[model samples]
Structures are given as C-alpha cells and as structure tokens.
Target: MDLSIKGTNFLGYLPSQKGTQTFSTFSCRYQKSNEEVFHQITESELEIALEKASAASEKYALAPIEKRRNFLREIIALLEEHRTLLVQQFSKESSLSEDRGNVELARTQAQIQTYLDFISRKDWNLLHSQELNGVSFEKRLCPIGPVVVFGASNFPFAYSTVGGDVASALAAGNPVIYKANPFHAGLSEMVAGIVLQAAENNDLPDGVFSLVQGNDYWIGETLLKDERVKAVGFTGSVRGGEALLNYAKERKTPIPVFCEMGSLNPVFIFKDAFEGRTKEMVEKLSSAIKNDGGQFCTKPGLLFIEERGSEMFINAMRDEFTSAAAVPLLHPSIYNSFLKLSSVFDRFPVYRVEATAPEYSVYPQLTEMTAKEFSAFPAAKEEVFGPFSIIVKCADESEMKACFETIGGHLAASVWTDQSLSEEWMYLLSSRVGRIIKNGVSTGVAVIDSMHHGGNFPSTSDSRFTAVGKDAIYRFLQPVTLQNFKS
Candidate 1:
C-alpha cells in the first residue's frame, strides 16, 4: 500500500502553541504491499492555514458567485480530463473495479457541480420579512469559519482528500483543512495537489485549501478541539465518528461535528411485492451487496422480507452472493474483522439460511433471521462492515412494522412496494429513514441537489443535515438575519 506520510523535516508546519503536530509511521491498507512512510505537519501550520483561510474567506465569498462557479466547473473538467488516471488509482488503491471507480469519480465531479449550481443560485440566501410596526425580520446564510474535513478511508477521491467534504466547505465559502484518510494518503496528496493547483490558478489564497498528512486519531482530536475550527465533517464507523464528536463537545469551545458514522440501511419488502418480483429483487440485491464491495454507507445491510417470499429470497440472495467476485478488502484488519463477525452470525441460533458458498472466501454473504426473532434479539442489531446482510423474515405486515421499530437509526431505507400500504407505516418510515427508496436498490446514492444523505442519531450525528448533495453547504454555513436593510 505504499503508505507514507511525508515532510517529517517540516515540523514547522505543526499547529502553534495551541497546535502540536507530529507525523507517525503507519502501514497503509489500500494496497496489497507494504511501504514504510512518514508524514509531517505541525499544529502551528494548521493554525496558520486556518487563520489565512479565515482571512481570505470574506473576499472569496464576495467574489462574483460566477467565478466560484467557474472554479468548480474547471474542477469538473479536470476530473473528466484525468478520469482515466483517477479510475486506475481508485482501482489499485481500493481494490475496486475500474467501472465502479469511474462511477464514483463521476459522482464526485457531480457533487462539485451540484455545489456550484447551488452557490450560483439566488434562492440559497436567506429570505426576510419587514414590517412597518417598528420591527422587521430578516435571515441570511453566512459561511462558518475554517472547517476541518476528515476524509473517509473507503473513498479516496470522492469521499477523501478534496471530496464532498472539501467541495461543500468550499462552496460555503469556508476554507478547509482536510485530514486525509491514512489508507489513501498518496491518493490524498495527489488530489490535494490538484485542488491546490486549481486554487492557485484561480488566484485563491494559499491557505484556502491545505492538506495535512496526519495518520493518527490524536491529530483529529486535536483539530476537533481547536477553537479556531468552526465546524467539522467526517464519514466513517460509528465508534470513530462518535469519538470525534465527543471530543469536540468536550472542548472548551465546542463546535458542530457532522459525523456520518455508519448505517445498516434496511430494505423492507412487502409480501405481495416480494412474491411478484423475487427474481428482479434478487438481481437488485446482488448489485447492491456487491456495489463497490458494499463499502457505501447507504448499502442495505438489513433486509426485511415477508414470510411467503422468505425462502425464495434467501435462496436467490445466497445464489447471487456466492457468484459475487471476491475482492480484497481495503485492509487485512477489515478482512479479519468481517471474517470474525460473520462467524458469529453462523453461531446464532436464529440463523436460517445457508450460504451458496463458503462465507469467508467471498466478499459478501447473505444470512437470514426471522423478523420476530430479530426484533426480540439484541445481538442481531449490530452492523458487520463488509458486504454482509441480515435477512429478517416477517410473518406479516405487522411483523414488518415490529422489525422496523426494533431496527436502529439508519442512513437510508428502502420500501419495495408499488401501491401504498397503510399511511401510518409510510409516514413512520418516511420520518425515520434519511434517504427513502422505493422500487429500487438502496445502494446507489445519486449526487444531486435534493438528495438527503443523512439520518437520525447513529446514522449521523445530526438528522437535519445532509453530507452530500447541494444542501451539504448548509453544514458549513450558518443562518444569519438582516433587518431593515436598503441596498
């Protein structure tokens, strides 16, 4: 994995007295091979970066919105121009297929476009009402100060480096200090350089977007607690995200931490729907489970199927999963963890379905449990990271409701139904899921303006915010009010 943190000699970049930066040696996970490496950045450097960025933010924001739009347009153009190399890097580092990498790359660019389109729009600004009764009301959107963007390990270009986090932060007129994911440090540097290059060409400030190589959790804690940082964005495991959020809250000057931890996105299938489209459902299931090695946060890890289709669904799920190509997980730890947890599912007494092939060898597995049993069971509530799913068979519609009630918070949910069932259940699920899907797979999250990519509680630190789509800017922007103004 050619894992190397660079610039050890440049400890001067560390955060000042308020910031202490140190680079450490860590093995990279994305690659099949190992390489010793070191990265150097100081707390002082981070502070300076943030300070300079903060200073430039207002000016950057004041620039013609069209110019910002053009910058993102250029970025999209560059992404397309270098699409081939980006695809290759993604495949080599993440062990993803070239096609999947390309799709992600395209989505990443689309995210940039979405942000640009949003920023250029006039309606994104707050609206206000004025009254002649000696009082008026006004509201507006203002960029938060410097933002700390913690990138994800699974997605190098899109979710890491100058991915959605940075893109959204930039769109919000906030300078970003992106902490690259350790797994894709090289890729981070590569993309960060590109972004910096674009910024320089566009006359953006040096500190507007700075990339630091910190391969440890301590660095993130340090940054999260830093008072200069106005906001934070992260995507990773629940434990990791929660830790960051907790640290931020514990700080003397706490800040908003938008941590999209993880989710066991549930796919609910009604008895009628399941019976009619078992084959179609299975095909969709296969694609979703195997999509990008099932690394997406929105991947449907839990399936709620009615009793009648349970047997056929299990068989098809297994058949499709068995045929899925085995790809190396990002790291040996992930691989081992998936193996260990999957074994635990086999040991569970309620497990009903058998695998089409040995579970350990393949990338994803299909395991089944009855909805009643799963609802009553505490152990079944956990999420197993890799391409693993727990099928919950429901006896009836009521059982499905029970299953959902028992399920934990999720990033997204899917209801495979043609006709609306009961309005109560519909409202219940609609209120619960972050991104609700109907008659389709739950995996592919489109990068669009209206897409809601967040959910309540553990699915994300905040329910009202979205991590992707045009609305992502809201994470980096806060509402302001202006009253009795005449321009």
Candidate 2:
C-alpha cells in the first residue's frame, strides 16, 4: 500500500504481517468489470500522516494569508492541468458517464476556485475593534486545528478527497487529513498526490494536507479520537456519519463533527399545480430519479402527489422511470441494498410496482404507497441510497400535513404548486428542509454562493453550516478576541 503525507513523499507498508512486519490492512475494491483492489493505506501510515499534519498546522496557521491563497490557486491550476487524467480515473473507477466525469472534474476545479476567490477577499479573517476610553477589543476568525475529512462515495470529485470539505478547511487555513472514500480510493490518492506536488511547488508545509485510503470504520474512529484533530467533516450515509459522531463524542475531549447524511428528499405536488404542470414535473422528476443512479442526497426519493389529478402524471412517471436501462451502482453493496429495500417496500400494501422486466438486469425501481401507509411505517421514510422512489398518494391537504410531520430532516424539498400555498403548508415544509425548490426538481445542486446544501437533524449534524457554497468555510474556522490590543 502507498501512503502520501507531508509533501510528495510516499511510504510503502503491508496491511498485515507477522512478528516485526506486523501491520494492519485497509483495502478498497471498486466494482468495475471485475472487483479489483484499489489501494491499502495502513494504520501506522495514518498515525504518521496525522503527526505530520499536526506539525504542519503551526506553520500553516502562521503562514501569510497570501501564501494560503496562493496554495489554493496552485491546487486549482494543477487540477486544470491534469483535468484529463482526473476525468479518466474517475470514470474508469466509478463507471460514471464520460461527459459526466468531465463535468465533475470541472466542478472540482470550480469548488477550489470558489474557495480561492473567497480566500483572496482578505475580509474573511478581519478584526473589528471598538475603543471605549482606555479599553479596546478586537475579534477575528482563526483556523481550527487540523481537520479530518471523510469523503463521499457517490461523488468522488465534488465530495471526496478534493471535495468541498477539504477545500473549505484549507480555505479557512486549517490543515486537512482526508480519509479517502472506498468507492474511489484511487482517485483520492491521485488528488492527494497533486495537492502535495502543488503544495511543495508553492513552498507550503507538507502538513497542510494528507490523504489516507482506507475502507474501514476504524480509520475514521482513529482520526476522530486523535486529540490533535480539532474538527471533522463527513458526507455519507446516516450509519457512517453517526459512527463518526459517536467516536467523536466518546473521546475524552470531544470535537466538533459536521456530518451531511443521506435523506429521503421528498417533493409535494398540489392539485392545481398538478393540473397545470404535470408534464413539466414528470419530465424533470424522471431525469432526477435516473441521473447519478439516484445516489444523490437530494434526489427526490418520496413524492406526495395529489390523489385526484395525478393519474396521468403517475403513469408517465412509471413509464419514464422503468424505460431507461439501469446503470451499475457504485458498488455491489448499493445494488444489494436496492434489492433488500425492494423487499421492505413489498411488505407494505403497494399501490403500484414498476421495475426493469428482467430480474437481475438493472437497478431503477419505483414503488407506490398511500399517505396513510407512508406515515405509519418508519422504514418507509428511511433512505434506500439507490435509484428507488416511493410515490405517496395524498388524498387532501390534511394528509399532506400529516406526511410532512413524518418526514425527517432533509437537505431539500420541492413544492410544485401553480396556485398560492396556504401558510400552514408553507410553514410545515419550510421547518423540515434546508433548500426548497420552487416547482423544480430537487436533484441539480448548483455550486454557487447562494446555494444552501444542508438541513436539520438526521440530514446533517449542523443546519447553520453547508457542505457546498460559500458558507462552508466557516466550519473550519473559529473566532478569537483580543482585548486592549494594538493593530
């Protein structure tokens, strides 16, 4: 296994050995053609990586703000320089579409560029002071200690090794130790390599960044328990996020954990809205369900459709959802999860069931249930994490209200309404979701400053911070105040 840390240096360590060669192993296997081993980054390597990160934090924090800005700029330039290699590796490992891979590669560069642009503003860390007689106080943002970032499985580029968390932490002047997501471990290593080279070229300390490739929970646990790690950032399933949270809390000095877990992002369609915009909703939603194999955290997995006027819309959706051939999921676990959750949905009295005609052919599956059933069972609201959606027929406004009460915290929601919404309905939905799409699909998340990619409990650890957009940098920054100090 190859581990990268503290510059462009590499360490070769065996996963497990006997006597003097004893070492732990962490292997990542991707599902492309045949399952092939991606990489193994050992425990000893991870310890050394953290040590270097801690050492780097002192210099990185005190380094001129301009140097950090230049470091970020160098990363963006290097990403652009190796755009082809990144896109190729991302596609080859994840089996995502070539054009999509290229777009993601661009998005990665853009994410870093967003941080760079924000960091260059210089006001991010500015101090404000007020003098009263002989007393004066000034406050400014300071970098939290080295941060541990857990990457995303579905989004290797935008949310993985070089994802928003890593970018935001660096932008705020914190050293980042990225735990590579197993689904794209190879890409993570490559991105780490690029950052190390770029950091060395920019004369930044090696401790500013480190990447360790491992698929085990213990790796995350180890990092969370490390006293030197002041904060952690994560994006993945609820179980994974919660495990990291638990690890953090169990530590003697618990640290802050910012986790963005998956959610059952739901879309509600009013009858009047259904009457005027059924076609638009159907087209927009069908693409959302199929795109990225429905692996997105904000994918509209549940729909609250009006009972009276949704027959045509539902029929159109069924055809659209089932017509497309299923692309392979990121791994076999996701595929099996789709199968298991299919059985779970079957346990309920389904209004409709549509899947690819062949048994083992593809992954897209659509199931329907009444509003009453959807509210009755907790499992119905749980995230399936694949190309699966449940349609809940809402007979009236009251049922929709009841449905909203059952909804857990979500990253986003959509209300496709042509007519005015009652204040009650607006209030009900607004309190439960972060980003609300007005009459549009909830899938496409733009990487702009105005976007808020977070939500309430169960959806994310903190609603105040976002995983994407400009506000994300704050997660890695703390504030300090100096009294009676001179400029």
Candidate 3:
C-alpha cells in the first residue's frame, strides 16, 4: 500500500484538482498548519461526482450480495495492512495518542466486519413471503440509491471517511459520496484511497464510491440539494445536522437524513450507590469525563445526585479533575468552541483543574448547581464539547426526576443505584433517552446487534434508525413488495 497523502479529491476513481480554492489541515500536536495544501471540490467537480454516483447506483445495487461482501472484506484487509501507517497519520493529524488511534482504527475494522457478518446470514435480505386469497407476495429490502455521507470530526477513523456510514451505505448497495471533514483531510484522503482500491480490486462500478474534499459549507449544501441523492448520513453538531435536514426538506423530493447529533448524556447517582462505592464510582466517572479529552458525543455532560451525600462525591470529583493532565483537542476550532461553551459555567459555582500543558490543550472542569438553578438556566442543558460536566445536586428523588424531565432527548442516561429503580423512573428515563445504562459510564458505546446509538429529537434526526452497528445499514435501504412476481 502506498502511504502517501495526495491532497486531491477522489471523483470516483479519478483524482481531480480542478478547484482553485484550497485549504490545509492543522497539526494539533505541532500546534501549526500542515505543509500539504488540499484542493476543495468545486461545484462542477461535485456535479461530475454526483453524476457518476447516480449513473452507477443501479449497477452497484443490482450487483450480487457476495460481490458487495467481498468488497467490504477487501476493505477490512486493506485497513489492517495499513494499520501502522494509518495510526501514525491519525495521531499526527488529530493530536490524539497512538493508542487511541489504533483503538479507533480497530473499531472501524470491526464495524465493517459486523456488516460483513450481517450480509452473510441466510436472511440478510430480510425477505418475507405471504399468501392471501391465492395471491403470492414477497417483501424484501432494496437500496435507496446514492447517499451523501458527511464525516464527523471527533472519531476520525470510526465516523469519518471509510467509517460506519460509508461501510453501511456500501453494504446496503448504495453508492456513497463521502464529504471529508476538513479537520483531518489528509487522513480522510488516505482512507478514501484504500476504499477506492478495494472497490477497484472487486471490479466495482466507477462511481460506487467518491470522496469530496472541502471546508466550505456550500459543498455539503450542494450535495444535499441534488435530486439524485436518495438519502444522507451525518454525524456532527446539532446545528450542522439541522442545516442538512433543512436542505433536504427544501428539495423538490425530500430524502431521509439520518443524522447522529450531539447529546448531553446524563448520569443519575442514588444515595446508596454513592455511599457504597464512592471511590470506585468516582474513578469511573472521572475516567469517562477525561477519556479522549471528553470529545465523544456520548460523554456524560451532566450528573444528578441527591444532596445528602453529594458533598463528598463533589469533592472527590474535584480532586480527580485537579490531578488530571490536559490534552490537545482535535482542532483549534474545536478547542475554541470548547472554551466558549465551557465559559457559561462561570456564572455558577465552578471548580476547574488546569495543568502546565502545551498549546491547544484544555484541562478538565466541573461545575456545580442545584436542580432548581439548572432548570432555570437554559444554557445549563447545552453540551459543552470537551472535558467539562455539570453536577446537579437534587434535594430529593422527585427533584432529580424533574431535572431529567427538563433535559431534551439524549443518546443515553445512566442510573447508579444499588436497588432497582421504580417503574415510573425507568419509564421516564427510557422515554427520554435511546439507551439506559445501569451502574456504568456512558462513554464507551458497544457496537452490536441490539445497540441503539441514536436517540429522539436533537440527538438524531431520525429515531427510527441508528448510525452504528449492523442495523445502521437499514437506514440506506427501503422495503419493496413483489406481487405474484417470478424471476
């Protein structure tokens, strides 16, 4: 595998550099701009890619499932083959540790393997046959045509180019036009190159996959406005997702937009749980908050605890935050956003921990507030996308429940209790969140058959579908019923 980064857009298999507008990715580790200059995809270049994808969608969709599976298999093999170089580039571009990079890369490969396993099953097509009044009918899943995937900035390998969205879209037989996140454009380009290689090796259609590189908002807007695009897959801030959703709605023929947006995943701690395992819970929560500098969307941004034993837990958390070392975020823009959002906590009682760290690095912070104060302050609910969390001290169980009610939809909410929670409590928590964690942290998301990484409203555009795991492929597929049809 050639591990060179060519700062060009992959318009199908061809590398084109027609656009004069250019940008460069920053090195968070070096605290400076990278040397390579990347070309942005112009409207004309984007139109060509869209046309190719539109032209090849049917061919790719109609291709044998085994062929698609083989393409995915090749991608997995290529990813593993280039793991060392890819991890190096990932760490260099994102300023994340090499271990984190390797872990994310492995997760990316595992995600593809999960899809491969799904497609290999006998009932992979989800075929349902029925007979009524001597009439035969069969229902099966079909591709939704070319899909536009907007890469996420946080998880460069797991959610960016050649990530779950791209893998699931390809598995569902939909041609993908991947819009590379400019934060890690070089890494995205390398991953795109690997996917294109796999497609070529499998004798796939020319437009089965395309990569568009650009930092401008119009690039994504133009992709969403195209009538040929059947659906969209996005993972980013709520604002970014909403913008794409609006663009899709404004189109003459609206398409489904599966967006995995930000969430304020809250953790509720009962008196018994805190008292029984105070030290253990403190370590777990601190680790969750400080993991990857708390850049994950599922990072616990809020913690609800009863006021009786809240002081000890708060002090323990403060101690943990104070001792922790700071780390650089993925980009300057992300660091800037984190600083701006976290400043909102200054109005309330805030305990911050800072270390002697390099540029673009941020320390962990903890903010304290009462349930009533939290409800009164609308900004308290907003997600501060860094190692920052708000601790809400509730007077009683009812107050804690009320705090949960004030929160909008989230990806997950955790309950730390030694005893079983009431039916009412469970029902309310389940209704408000997509996933409920018991006696655990909300940072690590499991990619499995039953995993639900999506949530209601602002957490995701469509709660019906997920953006992770094997079920994610269903987002790019629609059902078709055949009546008395023969092969």
Overall lDDT per candidate, in order of appearance: 0.72, 0.77, 0.89
Q: Against the true structure, whose TM-score is highest?
A: 3
Tens-place lDDT per residue, model 3, 1-487, is 6759878999999999899999998877689998888999988899999999999998998888889999999999999999888998888888889999989999999999999999899978767988887888889899999999999998999999988999999998999999999998999999999999999998899999999999999988899999999999999999999999998888999899999897999999988886787888899998898888899999999999987876777889988887778878989999889889888779897776554567788888889998989999998888899899989999889999988888789999998988988999989987878889999988888889899988887898877778789999999989999998743
Q: Which pairs clash in model 3?
A: none
How close to the true structure is residue 355 of candidate 2, measured as C-alpha lDDT? 55
lDDT of 1 by residue, 1-487 (tens): 1122233211112322222443322222343353424355555665566677667677777766666777677777767776777676666656667787787788898888888887777767765556666766678888887888888877777788668888998888877888877665556665665676566667765567777676666678778887788899999888989899789878888788998887888888887776677888888877887665677787788888877846777777777766666655765556667778777777543232344433223356777777767877676777777777888877787888877887668888888877775788768777777877888877777788778889987888988998878888888888887766633
- When 2 and 3 are scored with TM-score, the better candidate is 3
Kindly provide the TM-score of model 1 when superposed on the true structure, using C-alpha atoms. Answer: 0.88
Tell me the deviation in Å of residue 81 in model 1.
Answer: 3.0
- Candidate closest to the true structure, highest lDDT: 3
Error of 2 at 219 (Å): 1.1
User: What is the lDDT for 114 in model 3?
Assistant: 91
Q: Residue by residue across 215-247, what tens digits does model 2's lDDT show?
A: 666778889999999999999888888998888
lDDT of candidate 3 vs native?
0.89
